[model samples]
Target: MTDTCVVVPTIREWECVRDYVANAREYGHLDRLFFVLVTEDFCDTDGMREMLEEEGVEGRVFDGEAREQWYEARGIEEYGDLIPAASHAETSFGLLYLWAHERFDFGVFIDDDTLPHDTDYFGQHYRNLEHTGETLAVESDERWVNVLYRNVEEHGLYPRGYPYSAMDEEVGETTEQVDHVVASQGLWTNVPDLDAVRILMDGDLQGQAQTRTTREDYGEDFVAATGNYLTVCSMNLAFRREVVPAFYQLPMDDNPWDVGRFDDIWSGVFLKRAADLMGHHVYNGTPLCEHNKAPRSTFGDLNNEVPALELNEHVWHIADDAGEDAESYAEAFGAMADALVADDTDYINDEFLTFVGEHMNRWLNCLDAIETGEPLAEPTPADD
Candidate 1:
């Protein structure tokens, strides 16, 4: 049996967390499944742990302080800096820490607002990761595959972070190929993951309507070819342990520009580029979940996303081009980071790029420390 850990980052009430735990227990592999709940700094860690204990669920709840303590005890305080407080990306820390210490075979990430359907959510992801037969491969003229295409009831909707330039490109054609699967992306019913702009324009902003449900017969899991990319929403995602080092989930919400919410999309782009170069595959469609999306200000979301809209168009392309010669996930990611820092694009912010690049390298270093079971050395003043 494959050991798996489910990581959820939430700021919701205990009732929401309890419901997700119950659903996972009902539909997922209970014995092999461990849960990791990451909450904001303001959330009560002790209360959360007590609730989980009362529910008899095997898991740990981490807030900012707990995360810091974990790193401090290991003498790797610098690593904790990679994950910001009050961000969905906190699960990245949970996943990486577990992989480095507890040693799970796979990590599954879901939003707190989501619940499992009658399907075997965890089992399907495990099977997809273990699949070795010929799987569907998509070839697109636009070098991108909107994974949401034909999979959702909505006709014109695309997944968040999908480039607007490629919105009109037909899905092209599908063929069959054999490859090793590294990541599996599941679909969601009720509410599909979309950018704020889309939600403002066409979505049921109040969550009062069920519009973006997944189509029943959406066909088998599919992957884009080496030169193409897919929009990977982290909310219903699972991936092999080997992919963790490449999937940092890019930290957000604490930056100066107020730009946020592209963390998963950008992380997915990096992972896909690295997976392509490393000769691994990422599959989409299976183990669907119901996203009972929590209500939020759509306009606020738009404000957070505005700055990255233009950057999204060209950033993944930069990753693809930068990672072409890489042979490993780490190398591919590092190459992309270097490219981001070196980019002279007008819309790209130099300071932000520098921060991102530095953190990318720092993330790799943290992985290295975990692999070696040694605390990362404190940086010298000059190094800082």
Candidate 2:
């Protein structure tokens, strides 16, 4: 039987973590739930593992050792420690570790606080992948699918990376659809999904009120949007094994941007652009889950999200321009990364491209090393 490797990143949200696993178990989705507790330097890995065992959740805990060793094997020991404990984006590295070492057809990501309200949560995501390219007639094609989620107040929420501009836009009304899709996103409920900006603007600390949301529900349907603005959060997102490497490139320490915040958003944009070039679609909307947001300050969220409100649009524009005539997703993605570094003065000195280049090379080396059970050749340093 095929199974999904469920990835979760956390610092100290233990109870929520327990509930997350319990919900899946209750729904009978725990059989293959590889509940990874991606903790930081300060978090107690032993305690975290104990908690999971107590809750009967099966999985692994990553605390940078494997990542460090992998990078060291590639002769970039200094870069191995680049993943920051201050930000949660290091979780991407943890997931990449699993992808390199384990065998799984799909990888599923869910926040520690999110829970499955229905018994078929995993099945829903599985079916989406199974039918990714199914076309009912000559005019129809299914690519990416998003599972919807509601928050504590019964208000529909958009994923963190979801574009506010595209929130009101229908799938094919103003946007264009691609022939295939590389990834799918699931939405949240109660807190329904909202970016840090929206959460800040609304000032709903309690998440107690149900605000009317756009494109909130598409009953039992897998939908895709044609606009450049649509994006997905890692909270309830899944990708095919082949697509993981494309989105796996996380911003370890690239700055002027928050390490924790925009990693997934920018990666989603990169993946979307690549998917589009590959004749694939990126979609969002059903297999609903619940996002009972924990209480936090709007100011804190604003601090983290304000940059993306401007940069995400800029990122997509760069990807689109760079993607013209691109032969493959890798080519398109590389060109986009280069352009991102070129256009922005702040990014020029950031060594963003160099890090990305090294990261990708290291990933390739790591994958090869894992398969052969031997250390791979050293990675060639990218041009400075």
Candidate 3:
């Protein structure tokens, strides 16, 4: 009757995972959605499971040591010393273990750090998945950025382009929203049984995301599977179990993985390459888990960020471009924008160097405006 499942991976995410499961159950589709948590630290498995059961939400936790074996099988023992603590890749690998060895039609991958502030978030994904595609997620207002394409390699953006395929040749007409949807926070559907997951497990990182994708054999419909850029914050992402492959441990024997930051980015790159071969679309539609405690990314800087972000949760009626319209805020995204446009670098490492936290909140704000005409605008001083 139901086609979607909720997959939460845990390492030290006991608290977050507990909150995520409870929120998912409150959404009304808990019966249809399977909740599975993979723990990297097996010792915590029983505690995490007990915690879930105590909360009236049932879940399954896979072996933590087996996860390590998955890595050894792939030759990643070298990075035993370097994998960053609490990195997306590390958390992701735990989730990947669940995906590779599990059975499901569609799976939603949500990070353990977030606690859904609203229950409707998951219900939306349930509806979107029924429509079409392997992935669906929130827009994050990624389309608004003019320089999005430039940061593809740097951000690991993906076969991810905005405005959603301007031309639709199926009937010689383009659609309004988008066909290439990347499901985060839950949609995760439309995987062709064994398509996205079957052959990709039990290999190195490249093998799980790269080699397996390119090396696989699919009908002309898909050559490989790709993931979302901003949608894949390692916090909330949902996809048909098959639309994406289960992740493999970093091949430490071949090369040590820094796992410092960019693991999820690299995951996007691998999936994008696969999707590109098949000529499929990737997008965001379903709402994922958001950090109510945090506003922006710790690794981001604010530039061209509408400036009035802190004043209001929504923005509308912006009546100026640059110049005095832009106040003197040193941490503004404009600095990053300048580096992106003026310099010869794909990433904006402006000499002005400012700290950008909550990197996607700015984009999420833009998306909220489009979804609801809520007033997200900041008024300019008429006297000035």
Question: Which runs in model 2 stand beyond 4 Å of their true positions?
Answer: 1-3, 15-31, 54-58, 64-78, 132-181, 205-220, 226-229, 252-260, 325-328, 344-384
Indicate which candidate wins on TM-score: 1
After best superposition, candidate 2 residue 89: deviation in angstroms? 1.2
lDDT of 2 by residue, 183-233 (tens): 667766666555666664565654322354433444434444432444567
Off by over 4 Å in 1: 13-28, 151-154, 203-210, 348-350, 374-384
What is candidate 1's local distance difference test score? 0.77
Question: What lDDT would each prediction earn against the true structure?
Answer: 0.77, 0.57, 0.36
Candidate with more favorable, higher lDDT: 1 or 2: 1
Model 3 lDDT tens row, 65-132: 55445445444444233222333344444433333344455666675545665547666655554445
Task: List candidate 3 stretches off by more than 4 Å.
Answer: 1-5, 40-43, 66-87, 91-102, 132-182, 185-231, 246-259, 285-288, 292-384
TM-scores, all models, native as reference: 0.91, 0.75, 0.46
Evaluated at residue 179, the lDDT of candidate 3 is 49
- Ranking under lDDT, best-scoring first? 1, 2, 3
Model 2 worst lDDT run, 10 consecutive residues: 136-145
The TM-score measured for candidate 3 stands at: 0.46
